[model samples]
Structure formats: C-alpha cells, structure tokens
Target: MKMALSIALLVVMTSSAGAQYLGNYSANPYAPNSTGNAYGAGSPYNPNSVNNPYGRYGSTHSNSSANNPYAMDAPKLYDSQGNYRGRLSSNPYDPDSISNPYGRYGSRFSPDSVNNPFGAGNPYVPDSPTNPYGQGFSIQGADDD
Candidate 1:
C-alpha cells in the first residue's frame, strides 16, 4: 500500500509540473524569445507586470513566420492597415512542432507581450482559444509611477 501511495504521489507531482505555465520558448524556435519559458524582466507575467503570470499566451507578430519553413498554416497575414494577405500553410504548433512547431493559438509563442511586442497592425486572427493579446495591450498610464 505504501508503494502504491508513493507511485500515485509521484504521478500527481509530475502531472502538475507539466501543467505549470512556463511559456513556449524552447518548444518553438520560430517564436520570439519574449514569449518563451525563460523567467526574467520583459516577460508577460513578470510578477512585476500588471498581469502576474500573464497566463501563457499573448500578442503575436506579423513577420514571425516570414523565414519560418513551417510558415504555412500558422496564421493569416495582413499589412499595417489590417488588410487580409494570406494564411500560413505550415503547422507551427503541432505536437511534432519540433524545430518550428506551432504554438497554442497558431501564433509563435512568446514569454509575454512586453518582450515580443507585436507591432501595431498585425493581421493574424487566431482561430484557436489561446490568443489573449491578439488585439494588443493598451493599458494607458500603466507606466505612471
């Protein structure tokens, strides 16, 4: 019985660890380093930011998939004016997302919006459920110290 309890405890711990929000840096090379799992300043949930542990997803970039080989099927594109350009044909967040796997909302993962900073006029609208900052963050006077 003791052995079974230990095994169960181990499983629980492991499962929780997997669920921890660590961002998706190492998982997707094509993604910017800002939204990755690295812990530090400029991170979306830097404990210092208005939104602590800024969940795991945030704003996306327009040129993220430019040179990406898996740029296809990532997200539709657009110009600064929000014009519909085209859709990505590659899968950046698949489980096999090795090298350039797609992230949660099909947009390249970033640790937070601060680090990545998706410029204005991004045209990719995430069809998935993980896109939190697709429209971008606009906290006026947020920096008024």
Candidate 2:
C-alpha cells in the first residue's frame, strides 16, 4: 500500500510540473520552451528562418491583436520591413489612420495599397471599367429615354 501511494504521488507531481511554466511572462513575446502557459504569443512568421518575411522580432508589433495570420480569416497586410501590419478594417491598414503611410496595404505593391473611396470592405482597388470593384458590388445608372 505504501509503495502504491508514493508512486501515485510521483506521477501526479510530474504531470503537473509538465503543465507548469515560469511566471512574469505575457503572451506578447513568444518563447520556444515556454509552453503550458497561454502567456506567450507566436511570432508573425518564423523569425529564425531565413525565408521568414516578417521583420526583426519585437520591432514591428508581433504581438498585435490584429496580426493573427493563423486565424481563419487573417489579412495579408505587411509593413515595409516585412512585419505584419494589420487588416484592412484595422487602423494600421487604413489610409485614414495615422499609422498607415503606405495606405490600405502594409506594403508598397500598388494592388494592395490603392484606396477605393467609392467602395466598402477593402478600399484597395484596381478601379478599372472591366472590374472596378474587386469583391464589392457595383451600382448601375438609370436608363434614359
């Protein structure tokens, strides 16, 4: 009975230890060995990888609430430094916002930065007669006799 009791205690302690993490940490900065705690946020892209397009970690707000590319409907806005800016509806991606210098898009690509004053959703537009609104609907003028 004594042996069984000790073994059970040991198992319980180890299990709990594995699920524990160091204190004094927030989900803002992510850590490789810092799991079990929901306090760390992952870098927008693999900061360690050479192919990683995101700028230097912690330099461009990697912990931003709007930079969740892992989410179901993540936006594709990246800054000049290649850091994730934010979504179109978000401030960082909005031309009206003081933070958005490149306009709607986070990058310099014309297609992503163009602002559509006459549309909704994503104001970034081609504005051509063939396809003025990328995803937004269009309006027709009344016919005259």
Candidate 1: residue 62 Cα off by (Å): 14
TM-scores vs. true structure, each candidate: 0.22, 0.18
After superposition, the stretches of candidate 1 with alpha carbons farther than 4 Å from their true spots are 20-55, 61-145
Q: What is the Cα-based lDDT of residue 81 in candidate 1? A: 48
Can you write out model 2's per-residue Cα lDDT over 1-145, one digit (the tens) per residue? 9999999999987666531111111111233312112332232343321112362221223322122232222223333233333342234544422235566443334333323233222334332111323222111111111
lDDT score, residue 85, model 1? 27
* TM-score between model 2 and native: 0.18
- Worst lDDT run of 10 residues, candidate 2, spans 19-28
The TM-score leader among the candidates is 1
Please report, as a residue range, the 10-residue window in candidate 1 with the lowest summed lDDT. 136-145
**Superposed Cα RMSD, model 1:** 15.4
